[model samples]
Structure formats: C-alpha cells, structure tokens
Target chain A: MTYLLKQLGREWRFMLRQRYVLILLLCSFLVSGFAVFTGLAEVAQQQQTIERLKLADAKDRLEAQAKYNDPGSLAYYSFHLTYSEPSNLAFAALGERDVYPWKHRVRMLALEGQIYESDSQNAELAQAGKIDFVFVISALAPLFIILLFHDLIASERSSGRHDLLVSTAKSKYALWGSRGIVRFVAVVLCLMVPFYLGAMISSTGFLTTLLVSIWCIAYLAFWTVLSLWLGKKLASAPRIASILIACWVLLAFVLPILSDLLINHSVHSAKGGDILLTQRETVNDAWDLPVSTTMDAFAATHPQYADYSYQGEGFDWGWYYAFQQVGDQASTDMSNDYRAAAAKKYTLAGYATLLSPPLLLQRKINRLANTDALAAFEYEQDIRDFHKALRMAYYPWLFGQKKFDKTQLTSLPQFEDSTHNYKKVQNEQ
Target chain B: MNNKKTQFAIEANSLHVDIKNAPILRNLSFQVAEGEIYALLGGNGAGKSTTLKTLLGFNQPSSGKVFIAGQEVYSALDFIRRKTAYLPESATLYPHLSAYENVQYFLSLADIKKSEDELNQAFQRVSLQESAWHRQLQTYSKGMRQKTAIALALLREAPIFLLDEPTSGLDPVAIDEFNQLVRELASSGASILMVTHDVYGACQVADRIGLLRNGELVGEYDAPENGRIDTEQVHAAFAQRKAL
Candidate 1:
C-alpha cells in the first residue's frame, strides 16, 4: 500500500509539471462546470415557467367561474394547468425536456390538438441541444479522456525514456499503472466535481448521485482502457490518438444518428402533427353535421349520458361539448399509434446504446433525471388523465344529471402530476 | 580491474531474439562479474542496444536465457528491474521538469526515496553544474540532460547498470568525468554493461571490451595487469569489420 501511494504521488507531481496536461485538466473542469451551470439555469427556468403558468391558470379559472353560471360555459372557459415538474436531478441531464412539452394548459376541448401544439416548434433548437452535465460526461468527457490517455505509453517512447523508466521502476504497476491511474483519476475528478456540486445544490438523492458517478466512471474506464490498449499496439502517439478520436466520432455521433434514421424508417407510427390535424379537421367538420351525429358518437363511449336529450334548437352547450368529445375520440387511434411508435423508437435506441456507450450513458442519466422520452410520454398520459377527470366532473352537469352549483366549484378536478408516482416506482426498483 | 569478483551480476547465454521475424540478437553470450565494467563496442545495427535491452527484459529471448543478479530476467522482471538502472542513448527525462524533479520522479518510480541533500550530492557527483540543477531540462543542452539521467541512475544504487551510448552527446571534459564516474561505480562493487560505438571511451573505462558485429560477438579484449586496454587495437578491429 505504501509503495502504491508513493507511485501515485510521484506521477501526480510529475503530471502537474506538464503545462499541456494541466491545461487539458483545466479545460475538462471548466467545460463540465459550464455544463452544470447551464443545466441548473435551464431547470430553474423550466420550474419558473411552470410556476408562472400555474398562477395564471388559477386566476383565469377563477375569473371564468365568476362569469359563467352554467357548467358547460365554465368548463369551456376554465383552463387547467398540467405540468411535469422537473426532477431534482434534472439539472444534470435535462434530457428530452427540451424536446417534449412539459407543461400544457388545456380546457375541456378536443385533447389531441392541445397536446401536440408545441411538438413542432423549436424542434431544431432542441436538436442542437443544451450543454447539460450528461452531455459533458457522455459526449465531451471521452474526448478529454482521449486527450489525456492516448499518449500514455507512446509519449514515453517518443521521448526516448521508455526503456530507462521501465528498466528502472521496481514494477510495471509502479510505472505505467500509476501514471494511468493518476491521469484517469485527474480527468474523472475534473469532470465530476461540478456534477457533485450540482447534485448537492439540486438535492439529488444519494443513490441517484452514486449511480450517475458509477456510470460515468465505468464509461470513462472504457475509454481509458481502450486508449491504453491501442497505445500498446501502436507506437506512434498521433496514430493512437487518431484511432481513438475516430472511435469517439463513430460512437458519439454517427451510430446514434444512423440508428435513429433506421428506427424511424422501420417503426411506422402517426406523427404528432398528423394527430393534431385529424382532431382539428374532425372538430371543424362537426359544425356542418347534425347535432345528433356528434351526440351519437359521444354516447357510444359514455353510455351513461346517452339518455340525455339536446332540445335546444341553436348552439346548445351540451351539443357543443359532445362534438368536442367526439373530435378527441376521432383522433384517439392516431394518438395511440404516435405514442406507441415513440415508445418503440425509445426502446430501439436503448438497444443501440450497446453499440454506443455515450448514448447509453446519456440514456441512463436522462432516465434518472426523469427527462427522457419515457418521462415525456408519461407526462402526456398525465395530461390525458387530467383531461378525463375534467370531462367527468362537467359531463353530468352538461347532461342535466346534476344541478349547476357555484359552491361545488371547489370540488372540481385539478391537474395533479403523476411524475411523483413514477419516481416512487423508480426508487423502489 | 583487479577487484573483479567471480559472482556474475549480469549473464546472457545463447540468447536469440527476433523482432518482426528479423533476428536482432543471435546466440549472444556474455557476463559481467561483480565490481567490473564490461563494454559492448559496435557501430550502428550491430545489436549492442538490443543486447542491453534483452538483459533488461525489454525484449524476450526467442531461445536461451538472461539473468540479472543470478535470477532469470523474464521470470523475475520486477526483481531484475529493481536491481538495474538504465541510461538510454538520449536521456529524454521530462523536459518540463527541472533536473532535480526528473531525478526525484524517476527515483520515486523505483520506489526509492532520497533526502534533498542526497539528491544534491548525486547531482554534484555527476558534475551537472550547480546553476543548472534546478532548471528545467528543456533549457539545458544535450550534455546537461545526459548528466541529469546519470544522476538518476546513480541515485537508484542498483547492483546492475545498463548504459546505451552513455557519452553520445557529452563534451570531452564531461565524457572524461562520466568515464571516471563509471570506474568509481565499478570499484564500489556495481556491475555495468555499456553499449557504445566509442572505442576509445570504452577502452578508457572498461575492464573488458567485447567487439560486436552483425548481432554477434566477434572478439573480446581485457586490460593488462597494470594498464588500460589499447584503444588503437580495438579501433582497427572496428574499422576492418566495417570494411567487411
């Protein structure tokens, strides 16, 4: 143990003397620090947006409640705020939160259009992505690792010190092993110190933080071992570095992109825009159709409301709501297909991670942060569930089964995020 | 030359080494007894460095065996390395580090600790200028870097030494100082095997000189009872072998 410590200490001191090495380590620290800062800011911005929208939603609903005497008018005017609150660890990953709509304000209208409204906006921006901690680790940390380790052995040989150092050292571990460990530890520390600070500030759970650290270390070990292995086979530092950089490019960028294209081609599903268009067109066409047609379609799903009659000649509230319900029902099949395709694509990407370690790390941390595509899909489902609660609360009054009472407004359904349940289940696992 | 002991500190017997299917050393045999300096003198491609590397276990012998301190090199590499200190043709110690730091780092790599005064003494013994001791090797000349490497090797205090062109870049004065140091190390019971093309330098310091040509040891010469080996005789042999 004493010998190992001495060897490590010696290499640590030696590494500090090299300006290029110190610069690389500093760059790693700064880049990772910047990533953590941006991630925290982004998550804070998202939470702030959610809080702001909640206030406005409550105020708007109270005003609508004051203006409308009837349940149908109130349900039509009152918008409930549904949002997936960013997880504590989301400050690190910020995964699909940028791509998926995490917050939605929906009224008792056709649900599909409201859900898919923001899908196409700023997609290019999201694709470019924010500099989150996970991006720093999975994508950028490997390059830092490569720069640090690719020349571990070759540099010694180039300097004509390989033979002397090897022959003089008491053991191989005392020489190369110590040097490699020192470098690996330095790079890992540089990359993870910022993340740990972020975790503390975000109050990320201990187990999640540990898991993120283990995954990052394991991923870095993959690069470290690979660089050393290639260094052994190839004597030239530049050649070894070229091979490692090529590998980084292939795994971090090319494979993920190609697999995405292949998965999209193979997995057929309705697009979000298609779902929105289908629901909107159905709602538009309902104006020309007979009221009976809309009510008949709605009654097929809600048989309990079938006995209610729409006696009003022009613009009955019950008929208007029934047609809106029918519009959602018309697009239900397309919505399910879109979600199923998205789920399949996510699953296929999970398998592709075996080919690309960076993708695997990104996926793992994103899942932990509750910002993955799975999390986004769950949020959409939560909105749908909340919409169903809204419809249930108002449908009885619309169908004349219950008296319209302003005092009962306090008992109306409110949007509650199901992300807590998901997190609970995740923690248990 | 008279203080040589019978116990061999380094031994290579019938050693064969092939690199990329080309023979680097062929059936080579030699021994350096305790308190003796043996120099392998040859021109380029004569496999002198290869022979030195073989003794250090950097290259595995295709056949036969090498032993340092009476232990087979391949089976006891850690022991061999601990017992040996090597000086390469070009002592490219970390250029970013001062001479003191490079010596300290390499000695630490050997798991040997030295007091600051001891380090200063080793630098002083190598005759590296006091002014250059704390300067980074990058700013130093070739001879200064070589002196730093010599200081590191001396600090190892190992039983065996392997020197590859140990005086390749030194000035005439520095070369004489290095030769004197080698002689002093040998007198202090260390065994050394140096590979160099400098016939006169080898004759000046070596107790015994081996002439190598085309991976084979062609001739061996020993100093007379009270005199150094004749430099003219060895130089003639080297020149004639080049003609062949």
Candidate 2:
C-alpha cells in the first residue's frame, strides 16, 4: 500500500508535467462545471414555472368562486394544477423531465382532454441530448480519459521504458497497474470535484451524492479498462485511440438510437393524444343522445349514482357530469393500452441499456433524481388519482341537490407527490 | 561462492522457441560466468535479440529451459527481473519527464526507495552530466538516454545486465565511454550478456564472444588475456563463415 502511494505520487507528478494532459483535465472540469450550473438553473426555472402556474390557477379559481355558489360550475371552471416538482438531486440529472410534462392543469371536465396537455417543447432537443452533470461525467469524461490514457502502454513501449520497467518490477501488474490506476483516478477527480461542489451547493443527500460519485468513478473505469484492452490489441497509440473513439461514438450515440428504434419497433404504444382525441369524439357524440341515455350509461359504471331518479333534464349539471364520466369510462381500453405500452417501452429500453454502460449509468442517475420518463408517468398517475377524487368529491353535492358549503372546498382532493409539499396560493386580488 | 556455483551466471539447456507457428530458435545452449562480459553477434535474421529477450523472460521458449542465478527463468521471472537490469536497442525514457525524475520514478517502480544523493551517484557513475539530469529526456541525444538506462541499472544493484544493441547508433567516443561503464559493472561482479553488430566493439571489451547463425550458436571466440584483439582476423573469420 505504501509503495503504491509512492508510485501514485510519482505518476501524479509525471502527469502534472504533461502540460497537454493537464490542460485537457482543466477543460474537463470547466465543461462539467458549466453542465452542473446549467442543470441547476434548469431545475430552478422549472420550479419557478410551477410556482407561477400555481398562482395563476389560484387566481382563476377565485374568479370561478365568484361566479358560482354551487358545485357544478365551480368544478367546471376551476383548473387545479398538478406539478412534479424537481427532486433535490434533479440538478445533477435533468433527464426526461425536459421533454415530459412536469405539471398539468385539469378541471372536472373529461380529464382525458386536459390530462394529456403538455408544455410545448422541442423534443428533438432532448433526443440530441442535454448538457447536465450526468451527461458530462458519463459521456464527456470518457473523451478526456481517452486523451489521458490512450497511449499509456504504447508510449511506454515507444519510450523504451517497457522492457526496463518490466525487468525492474516484481510483475507487470505492479508497474503498469499502478500507472493505470493513477490516470483513472485523475480523470475521475477532474469530473467529481466540480460535481461534488454542485451537489454541496444543491444540498444533495449524502446517500444520493455517494451513489452519483460511485457512478462517475465507475463510468471512468469502464473507459479506462476499454482503453487498456484496446491498447493490448493494437500496436500504435493512434490506432488504439482511433478504435476507442470509434467505440465511444458507437456506444454513446449510435447504440442509444438503435435501442430506441428497437423498443419502438417491438413495443408499439398508441399516443395519449390519440386516446384523448378518441375520448373527445365519443363525448361529442353524447350531444345527439338524450340526457336519459347519458345518465343510464353513467349509472352502469357509477352504480352509486344509479338510484337518483330525478331525470327532468334540460342540460342539468348532474346530466352533463354523467356524460363526462361516461366519456372517461368509454376510452378505458385505449388508455390502458397506452399506459401498458409506455411501461413496456421503458422496460425494454432499460434492458437494451445493458449493451451501453453510459446509458445504463444515466438510467441509474435518472432514477436517483426522479427526473426520468417513468417518474413522469408516476406524476401523471398521481394527477389521475387526484382528478378521480375531485370528481367523487364534487358528485355528492351535484347528485343530492345539496348546496356546497364554501368551507368544504378546503377539504377537496389535491395533487400530491413525495417531493410535493404545497399550500393553497390564494389570489390577493 | 564455490567454483561450480560461481561458474554460470546464466545457462540455457537445449532451448527451442517458435512464434506464431514458425520456429524462431533451434536447439541452443550457452552459459556466461559471473564477472564475465559475453556478447552474442549475428546478422539481422540471427536470433541475437531473441536470445537476450529469452534470458530476460520476454520470449517464452516452446521447449527446454533457461536458468538465471540457478533459478528457472520462467518459474521465477519476477525474482529474476527484480535482480536483472535491461537496456534495449532504443532510448525509451519518458520524454515528458526530466532525466532525474525518470530515474527516480523507475527506482520507485522497482521498489527501491533511494535518496537523491544515491540517484545522482548512479548518474555520475555513468558519466551523465549533472545539468542534463533535470532537462527533459526529449532534449537528450541517443547516447544520453542509454546512459540513463545504465544509471538505472546501477541504482537497481542487480546481479545481471542484458544489453540489446547498446551502441548501435553512437559515435566512437560515446561507444568507448559506454564500453568503459560496462567494464566497470563487470569488474564489480555483474554478469553481462550483450547482443550487438559491433564486432570490433565487442572484441574491445568482451571477455568472450559467441556467434549465432540461424538460431544456433555457431562458434565461440575469446579475447586475449593480454587485452589485444585482432579486428581484421575476427572480421575475416566471420566473413568466411558467412561465405560457407
């Protein structure tokens, strides 16, 4: 152990003397620092956007409250916002959250229409990839690793140090292994120092920070091991570097696209927008049907409302809500297929990630941050549950013809997540 | 050490080698005594470098065995390498590092933690300039890099030294200086096995010379005890043998 430390010191000094490598290391740190800062800025921006949405929703609800003393009109006009607030560690890994909707505004109307409404963002940007901390460490760090260690063994052979060093050491591992380790640690630290600062500033949990640090180191090791393996196969440093860079391009860019194609080809999921459109077409057809027909359809699924026998209906709130419920009920099959396909695609993509360490690690980081597509789905599901509770809570007053107490609005169902802790943002106006 | 124990610092017993399905070395055997300077000479195709590599445990033989310090070369390579110093045909010092740093790093790699004074003494023993020790090896001439390799050997304090074309591209003065350093090492009881094309250089310093032809030891010649070598006759004999 002592001898290895001595060798590590010598190796570090040797690396420090190499000005080009040192400059590359500095560049690596700069790039990662930028990425961390940008990621945090993105998370902050999303949080601010959520805050603004909550304030806007609160103001709109107040206007609805002034117009209606009963439950039906209030339920229809009051669009409650459901948001997936960024996790504490999200700054390090802003994954699918950029492309996916982190917040949704929905009312007591057919939720199929409002639930699918996502923020307008260019998805091509997400596919092109982001410059987050995980992106820097997992994708960019390897390039620097290749620069630092591409010629590790080959250069030793060129310099005529190979034979002498080999004969001097107890074994080949003792000499070259120490050198490999030193270079690997140097590359990892170049990324980690900036990342650690970002985590500290963000106040990332100790366990989360530790896991991310391990991921960064493991990613660097993957590249180093590959560089060394290719070093053994090729004779010249340039040849080894060329093959490694080719592999980087393959794994980082090409393989991920292929994995996406494979998952899409295998697991064909209909879009949620399609389901929403179909539900709307079904609900619009309810305009031609009699109010009795709509109530009968609603009473079939919602047997609890079956016994309310007052059907003197000329567009009553109870009759309109019955058809809205009927619309959500009629599209259940398509909605389920859409949800199942999404889950299957995510699972298959995960399986495909085994072929690329970078993707696999990014997936791990995304999970830790709760910023992935599955996290998006979880948030949407949470919103769906809250919407269901809102409809159920509003039904009692509408069906029984009982007047709604304004104080009871405080007890209504709210969108919730583990990270979500929000108070009602009442308008000052 | 007794006579038999001290007689053979290196020994090969009917060694045979093949690389990638082609025979590289035929049945061969030779030995060099402690405190003796032995040179193996051959043409380009001859296995001179291969023999040195074999002795250093770089090239594994298909059959037979080599012994260094009475330990089988392959079985105890780490031990053998730890005790042997190697100088290859090219100057392979890390160009990014200064001469002193290279020496110190290699010393540490060898698990030899020496003080700066001892490292400088080794450099001085090889007659390397004190000023050049701190300069990057990239600025040094070919001969200077060879001197660093020798200084490394001196620092290692090994019992055996393997030289592969040590004076291949040096001036007469540099070659003489290098030859004198080897003589000093031999006199200090280090066994030396050198592969070279310099017949005159070998006869000038070597106690004995072996000629290899097509992987076999074709002939062995000795320098006079009076330290006189007839380069013309040695050349004539080598040329005549080649003609045959």
Supply DockQ values for each candidate. 0.82, 0.67
Cα RMSD for candidates in order: 3.6, 3.2
At residue B97, candidate 1 shows an lDDT of 83
Measured by DockQ, the strongest candidate is 1
Quantify how close model 2 is to the true structure by its C-alpha RMSD in Å: 3.2
> How large is the interface RMSD of candidate 2?
1.7
lDDT of 1 by residue, B1-244 (tens): 1322235898888988998999988888988999899999999999998898888888889997887888888777888888888999998988888998888888877878899999999999989889998888889999999999899989999978899999988999999999999989999999999999999999999999999988989899999986899999999999988799
Write down the lDDT of every candidate, Cα atoms only: 0.89, 0.81
Estimate, for each residue in A326-360, the C-alpha lDDT of model 2 and write its tens digit. 88887888788888998888888888789988899
Residue-level lDDT for B158 in candidate 1 = 90
> What interface Cα RMSD is found for model 1?
0.9
